[model samples]
Target: MKPERARSLQWLLVRRLILLQAGMLLFFIVLLIVVLSVVKPRLMIDNEAAVTAVTGAVDRDKDGKLIVHDTDELTQFRAEHPKVWYIIHDTTGQTARVGMAPPDYDRDLGSLLSSVDHASIGFAGKRDGKEMRPEAFVQKVDTKAGPVQVVTSTFHSRSDSEGFDISITAIVDMARKPDGTADWPRVLPGLLASLGIVLLPIILAMGVTTLVTTPAVVRRSLTGLIGTANQAAHIDFDTRAMQLPVKNVPQEVVPLVNAFNQALSRLAQGIDSHNRFLTDAAHELRTPIAILRTRAELLTDEPETLRLRQDIERLSHLAQQLLDHQSLDRPNEHRRVVDLAEFAGRVAADLAPLAIEAGYDFAFEPPDGKVEVEVNALQIEQLLANIVRNAIEHGGGKGTITVLVDRAGGLEVHDEGPGIPVEEHKNVFEPFYRVHPHSHGAGLGLNLARQIAQLHGGSIAILNGPWQGARVRVHLPLHRQTA
Candidate 1:
């Protein structure tokens, strides 16, 4: 099964913020409608249709004065509300009146125009308590002739049964004709269509702003965590008790890093204790093995005694190999630059006697000039000794063994005996792996040599030599910086 993809915190936060912003926008729209229904602003007017109807019907005559041209829209307004009365004043001081006022409202066009100086519309100083605002306001409109002032008065019901000011929605419902039933689809589309067009830009800008900025905010908030993660990549067994520093870490993440550090400390201590026990055990067995070997050598030349000596010697060799493996793990020793050819020759001379005693001729071939490398001298010597000893033990007890030191900071050892098999080449470097079953030597020599070579930033390879025996090659870096 495929794993589910992980969601990014940055994008997740952006999406949630956008959703919250949309919700807030919706809530405010509802609240505005509720407040408009309850507490009406004194200036809110439902006069767009009247303004458009009057302005669109007037144009310039031969005298450049406003005159009605009798359009269909004006006819419709008159048909919808039979009580509509309007007084229009063009820029040229020309005026026109269409319908008559009621008998009780005996104001002329001039008096009605002058009465607009104050906000309240009243015949004397007071109106009947039932009506607050009749459609009596001075509105300036744009016409083809120029600017014109229009004053209108009409009575439809501006208030509901509870005397709360009616909303534009209720006013529209009241204006529906004939049977007094409202057709909302006919009224709402033109007025409410612009609401979505106006809101579209705001929603897009909000979502885009969230998408662009949330990742940066999340990244800055977790900068310390990112640094800690980079440091965690370098952790390994060689680091021992290394712990992540938590001083600059965020407060919410401190506990997790602290717990990880504690776990690393415990693991390091456990490995250290295990290594210490092995080294101590190897040290303790050396004395007992030597004593038993000495006693076995002193026994008479019987077959049982000879077998006992060989077993004791083998036991002693195994313990020494264990000690060597443990000791090479510590790389704190200081290293110095030395000539590679001179060092290899010295190591070959020291191991030549052991090869001669095993009935093999030993030879050392040095490079033409000096090849230099930075290495710990004692450990390099032990590595060379282990490789030559492997050749002596497993080279079928016959012809010449050659140690060639390369000028390019490497060494090659070749022996003239039955060669190692091609398939077993890689397995020969594994610990406790022996090529010939009856061989009396411990099988950790090549494994230890390979470890030491890698510690110095080098490698080892086993191959078939030209003279019918296994060839072992070692390569080291040329003058590496010491740690």
Candidate 2:
């Protein structure tokens, strides 16, 4: 399957991280709004308290009415809280007195103050087990002096059976212009500035955190995936006990890993069954063929008896090739370093007499130095025997068969016979595949040789030789150090 690079596991992790940061940013915005809402009420309470403290500090008579005296404390209080104006009024709606008012303080402040209702401003009750309290009456009024914003509150002190009112006027210029127009210009920029100052840092901090952690977290999560890939790459069909590890693997890929292991198990079982069938069948056929060969030899040295003996021997060789092919499938338990040049020379010497009897010349060319390789010695011997035997049986003429070895553990068999066609070269290594239908040999020889070569981490290829012959070259890894 082609990988979607943009949608990899790390991409998904980074996307999720960004989404989480976005959610946090949204939460921060909500919290900021909540804080601003909560703080608004506290600011109103502070305004009310400042007004009340200044209003209550005025000199008072025994009857709790204002004594109409201005002290240094009152002047300082008025200077510190410029937004407040004081008013003394009788409950009977008479003209009121003002002290420390702004020059543009509306002359109509008295009429606007008299219109206030104390009972309407005292909003308090218990409803549904919840208490509600109202702080102050804050309002804007157009006065003859100009326009003014006022927070009207009454401060009352108690005497026996009598009450007096000091109707205080706390102007709220922070909410308006001198014309009492709504002062959104002053408030909106400050509100937005505060929100930006709070939100930008939070966003930058979260983005950096996501960038730093997403790759590490994604890599940590894929550790099991990398391990599973390595296991699949190195799986050997000869062994059935190996399996991918489940511990510490991610839950998302657990099922895939389990499925791969199950597939490996099934494949190993099938190969085992095939190898067993071949070995058993070859063992079963060998005895009958051996008896036939013995019976033909016992008959006379006539041409008919000699031909029959050769046929039986060919059958015996085919049976042995089947056994050799089956042996290649078994896991190699003993692989030791052996001299490749000497091994090839010995096998070639053993097969040279057979080639001589077949009206051919067989030669062994050994390398000057030892060519050592790590392999199962029995399988390597079988591989050399099969290649030499193929050349002797099907060279198409009484030509020379030469076995050459090199220092790199490479072996080459060159025969002065018609080379294989290029189209059939690859197919020649398949079991039971033959180039010539009338050839007096089963085609398992080359196939068995190929299997053994592969088992030893080597490869074999058939090509046209330098002479008018076919060359089978086997390239095996050389063992630099003896084991």
lDDT per residue (tens digit) for residues 87-173 in model 2: 443333322344443222324445655565321244356645753332334343333222233443322211111243344544433
Once fitted onto the true fold, the runs of candidate 2 whose alpha carbons sit more than 4 angstroms away are 1-7, 16-62, 66-213, 236-241, 298-308, 463-465, 481-483
**lDDT of model 1, residue 35:** 96
* Global lDDT scores for all candidate models: 0.78, 0.70
TM-score of each: 0.67, 0.63
- Cand. 1 TM to true fold: 0.67
Worst 10 residues of 2 by lDDT: 153-162
Off by over 4 Å in 1: 1-5, 31-196, 220-223, 247-251, 434-442, 464-467, 480-483
lDDT of candidate 1 at residue 115, scale 0 to 100: 38
Report the C-alpha lDDT of model 1 over 340-418, residue by residue, as the tens digit: 8998898888889989988999999998988889988888887888888888878889998999988677788898878
